[model samples]
Target: MQNSSPPKMNATEQAYHGIRNDILTGRLKEGERLTETRLSDDLGLSRTPIREAIGRLILEGFIERQSGYTTRVAHFPEDEAEQVYEIRRLVECYSVQRAARLATEEDIAALRRIHAAMQADTPPRDQAAYQRLTEANEEFHRTIVAAARSPRLTALMTTALDVSMVVRTYSMFSEKDLRRSLNHHAELIDAIEARAPDWAASVMSAHLLAGAARVAARLKTAGSDDGQD
Candidate 1:
């Protein structure tokens, strides 16, 4: 049976997750300044946790601290984004292949729950619902990674799955693209259920490539807009 207990988290850990989610969902935004004082006020917490969280984000490549006095959300540049997708494709292809061999029935069910939430005619309609969908997407991929049972592979993927690239890529997904992505998740689960590692890896590769293309286009559009401005 799966452990039903929630993992314990300190204030700093909680603050880290909260701020990370905001960054991933575009609530924080790329290139937006992050002031400890403003974050403390917005999060209704002390500066200590907020400060700690920012420090961690910097190390994780989600935020950048300029010199010693400035901080901002990490921007998704085309060059860096290409590297992120390339690494994700390599790592996740291996991860999903292993998951096909290792994932339990319960793991499949957990993934299905996330997939169901992403289906057609049921797109997220509010801020909270959108947050749920975004987090569900993250969980679906993380579950596959965990099922791989490779700590090193998981660690590598974590770096590539940085918030800037993830949010910027997901932000450009149109409603049609969103539905197709959900379809891909369903197909991936089917591949895993069939214990076809190659099939599962192929699906994951296509998913990452599509996301990379979306993010690249978004960067190009943003660049054009900036030139106009």
Candidate 2:
């Protein structure tokens, strides 16, 4: 008997996820030219799906088309980063506030479990932890947002996370930064457990803004180093 599990995703979705992951993980390199033929061969798909995937990524702000011929990974614009964080802070704070009001015992417990996983997977150095932590951190946020029960807000927040991963890959975090993030996650979990809506909301806002500031600083430092070299 051929073990018949459900058929996996078709080519277009596979191509989309593969290219998106490469861009998010910095393997594609910001501003590096992308050719459909090359990408199709590399990802082992045909040009049709690869083109469709690139179109989707462009729609998602992960890639850009230029000079009617060239496509490249999108670069992080500092101003755009600031704007994204500002919107994220506002939306996430509101989401967490509602989550605190709505979360049940199960919700709080699940959040704690997600955080525990994050704590356990301490990536050595900041090298690629950004990619590794994406799912865990996303689950942590999604739990709170889902508790709010607002589909519209959840959709918006999902887009925000996608954009954030792009910015995060360009900024390396220090050990102190990682620890601070862990502590903030703990505080958030405590606030949710206590059903402190105001406190949870405030902590979530601070956590996002603080992360944005750190990433922005890292970008600046990287820019200076590049100039020196």
Candidate 3:
């Protein structure tokens, strides 16, 4: 039998995951400056791997290359942030419908496992707990996209997903919002299992729209506060 273990990451991959985890956990805050030398020292890796990791991150929309050969954690303006969700709606809503029709038993099983993980006994009480939930949530969505069996759609969603990570959409959630989101995921699974494309698409549409509205409202509130300041 072939080895079932996952492959160990190489140095560059290590750097990439390290940096991405920091960004996702807010250890590397949005718009925070980065330099290869600093990151090399911080991650205890050499500059070559750090440079390679940064390049990949920039391509994946996790880091932005600014003027003067500098880079920072990616941050979007309000308009672009809104556009991110619009694009997600366009991409993911369709993907979910395709998944409903195309997903195999194994694919559906993976999604259910992710959903069950998210539906832990208690709510996320701290940053670490929330991080686990967020990662699980991301996995749930990515699995659906994978089940859609479209590489082009996956590529299209790459940047949108990264931007959503940067925005930390779940941070804006209330207890009620969290419950509603869990329900949406459950409904999505049911639709996909039933092979109901229309139902799956409808649930995905509502899910994405609700998330977009939350992000937009938060952005508006932040903008208002900034103006006052």
Candidate 4:
């Protein structure tokens, strides 16, 4: 007899992408309980696929499953955020240093284009624009890191980027915050163009640390808001 073929994704992968996108874009708010039946009805899929998707998400750190209870969107734990930032600081600094050494004029030019596009758009203070800008910013950072041409560093940075996205989704920023971020990007680009490895590394480190500080403050503020209810 012929060997049986493995099942394709069917409903599970579809459900997984839908829920994952919702979480990443903040459509599913943090700490919101995910009911299998409700999600099944909404997505027009069976509970089995929804459950499987949730399981996958749990492994990916996007959702948390409690024993004999409902799963929920992952909450922004302050400690986790801090630790991720620390790791990001070290990895990104090294990546920027190497990038500064290896970056070509063409690479710098492409980054400039991305930066200009980011600055032109008046990102609305809503989750949608926030999500768009987040992706754009990731692209900008990825360009710099890619210049380094180190596969190991790239892999580690990619994981950190995912964690960073989770942190950012919970902590929304104001227009002022966005503008400040753009300014920093400009400075980083300038440093890179000057071929100043030390300066580029320092700027990238400070930029990442500043972002961590802002996110920490936002988390505290959000906590206070929750307590008021």
User: Which lDDT values do the candidates have, in the order given?
Assistant: 0.84, 0.80, 0.84, 0.80
Which ten-residue region of model 3 has the weakest summed lDDT?
163-172
Whole-model lDDT, candidate 1? Answer: 0.84
Clashing pairs in model 3, backbone N/Cα/C closer than 3 A: none
What's the lDDT for residue 132 in model 4? 61
Q: After superposing candidate 2, which stretches have Cα over 4 Å from the reference?
A: 1-28, 37-56, 124-132, 163-171
Candidate 1 lDDT over residue span 112-208, tens digit each: 9878876633476765576566667878888999888899988987877775566557767777778878888999999999999999999999998
Q: Where does candidate 2 clash, by residue pair?
A: none
Model 4: per-residue lDDT, tens digit, 6-53? Answer: 666689988987787787667887889999998899889999999999
What order do candidates take by lDDT, descending?
A: 3, 1, 4, 2
Q: RMSD (Cα, Å) of candidate 1? A: 5.1
The TM-score of predicted model 4 comes to: 0.77
User: What is the C-alpha lDDT profile of model 3 across 1-229, one tens digit per residue?
Assistant: 9999878889999998789878866689779999998999999999999999999989877899999889999885777767777888889989999999999999999988988888882378865578678788888888999999999989987767874443366666777777888999999999999999999999998998998888788778867976897
| Cα displacement (Å) at residue 160, model 4 | 2.0
Model 3 local distance difference test score: 0.84
RMSD of each: 5.1, 4.1, 4.7, 6.9
